[model samples]
Target: MPSQSKLLSITTWLLGLLTLVAMATQLTIHLRLNFSLVNFFSYFTNLANLLAALVLIATASLRLASRELSPALESARAVSAVNMAVVGIVFSVLLRNVDLGSLQPWVNVLLHYVMPVAVMLEWLLRPPRTRFTARHVGLCLVIPLVYLAYVLVRGAAISWYPYPFLNPAHAGGYGGVALYVAGIALVFWLVACLLLIVPKRRQVRNH
Candidate 1:
């Protein structure tokens, strides 16, 4: 039987490759329809999946090379895990019934469902080696807050928002969008807390 490290490396490689394929396929479909590349990449789902794929691939490569992941990379893994969790939850709850006009079915499943679940499971099964702190949780929120700002600013400029919930027009105006943003931020915080707490509990049980 392969050791735990070997198994983890293989799993990460497979998942990372799968994520890349899904994102690539989606990108092709988007370009074929003449969609803005900027808008396509701006979706939190795409960005989170991209980050998750990179972190997974990088972690696998370092492990295979017998090199330890840097603390920064490990923290990235933690943040990516939290991001993917929120992606899954938000999509299922808010966007599952919404028409994503150009998105292919298989790609949708991979990005909105499979990759998110896989990334979270990977984190749960193989939690970060570095201990997490309040600072780490804060780090988890940084990209999300940045993404929120970018979406609002860009949406204001182009009159387009990736998710309807983020669109003032669709959401009944900026106030409604604010409500959605506040709710999503709360979700991010809760998921980040859970991710941090779970690993500590696991370590305690093992000890």
Candidate 2:
């Protein structure tokens, strides 16, 4: 059987590669003369995504340097990737509807959804050193909650939110956005906890 450390290392390295690719792609789009699908998402969502990608990449380094976080800790990190991916998808879709170029629509979906989904699935199948529990769910919520709060405060002053629904000036407004975010957070928490409970053999057998 593969050691947990090895599985984690592989996942971490793959995430690192993807993170680097995303950074490079964004940089290229910014510097190059070519106009592409890079503008499909709001700048805020893209910025958030870039930060999330950085976090995912840094977790790999943390694992390499000190192996301090548990397998569960790594799993918690997976939720961040998922969160950013989903948010990016939502933002990108909004832009697509506004007549952004097709290339950006494709790139947005590919980067924000496809790549993250593939990487997350790889992590899902790896054997857990410990059973999934309530604590695991708690960890999943913490980071996003902090991030959302920061966004809310910033939105209050700047009157800008990543998505229209999140903006206080919109019809549904910040209240509606807050509710939606809370619901998504709850769903994510439950999903993470359920993932922990699923037996490894059953998960792997499906793969």
Candidate 3:
């Protein structure tokens, strides 16, 4: 019989593989229909999918059981988990009006909703052994900051931002961009705090 950890590992691996396939198929269809690879890759949704899948695969491959992940891996998993949730929330709130007829609707749902929920559930179920400190909050911020810089710089050059709010050409302009960044940064921090709380709560329960 498979151990509980082994079962957990297998479950994550299957979910990750499912997410990757759905994402890949959707992206392939999107590229074929739109013929704009650059535009496709620029979306934060795609990046989130990629990040979640990679993190899940890494966890499964390492056979990470319990809440005992190394600090670095724990941080990575936390960031990735939050990124997935952000993708779903942002899509529903900000991008729901955007038509997604090019890709299968089910795949779209999987990428935006199912996978994000799955990642979050995984995070909650497998709280890390190492509780993140306030300082690691800054480290968690780095990935999103880098993502924002990439979008802004690329959009500046090509006049094509992945999201309307992030585009200077849109109504918000630089101010809008700043506002979006600030809002997202706040969200990121809140999510990080939630992630941190899990481990600390578990520690408390143990004592």
Candidate 4:
């Protein structure tokens, strides 16, 4: 029988491969539709999934090689897990009913549902040994903030937004967009706090 760590390594590798395949499938669909590669990659869902895939693959590689995992790598995995969770939540709550023309149902499920849940489960099952500080939480927020700014700026220039909620025209102007952004930011912060706090609480209880 495989040891628990070996099983986990296999699982991570499979999940990472699955994510990459889903992404490639989506990219193929987009290409057939003459979609801009830039626009396709710009979606938070795509970016988050990419990050999750990379982290999963890297962690699995390190584990399989019997290498010591770096704290920074573990931190990256935590951040990726948080981002993916938010991606799933925001999509289900805000864009569930939105018509996503040309997006395959299977691809949608993998990106917005399976990957997110799997990433979070992985984090819960194998948490970082290094405790997350408030500094880590703050650092986790940086990527989303930067992504938000990039989306808004790029949207203004090209008039294309990944999600309807972020589009000023669809969101009832910039005010509405601001409200949506603020709400998502709050959600991200709350989730980050919970992820960090829960681990510490668990460690305390175990001691």
**TM-score per candidate, in order?**
0.94, 0.61, 0.88, 0.95
lDDT of 3: 0.82
- What is the C-alpha local distance difference test score of each model? 0.90, 0.58, 0.82, 0.91
Mind giving the per-residue lDDT tens digits that candidate 3 earns over 1-207? Answer: 258768878888888898889877877887777668877777788888888888898888776544445677878888888788788778888888876658688888888888989899888988888767888777778888898999899888888887888987773679888998899889888887777788899999999
Compose the digit string of candidate 2's lDDT tens values, residues 1-207. 246866676666676566557656765765575543333233444554555566556655666576565664566555554455455455555444543332355456646665556445545654444454576667667766776677678678767555555666763866788776776577656655655565445656667
Cα RMSD for candidates in order: 1.6, 6.3, 2.4, 1.5
lDDT of 1 by residue, 1-207 (tens): 248878888888888998899899889989998999998999999999999999999988888888888989989988999999999999999999999898889989988999889888888877776878899999999999999999999999989899999999899999999999999999999999999997788778889
Instruction: Give candidate 2's TM-score.
Output: 0.61
Maximum-TM-score candidate = 4
Scored against the true structure, residue 165 in model 4 reaches a CA lDDT of 94
- How far out, in Å, is residue 104 in model 4? 1.6
Show the lowest summed lDDT stretch of 10 residues, model 2: 35-44
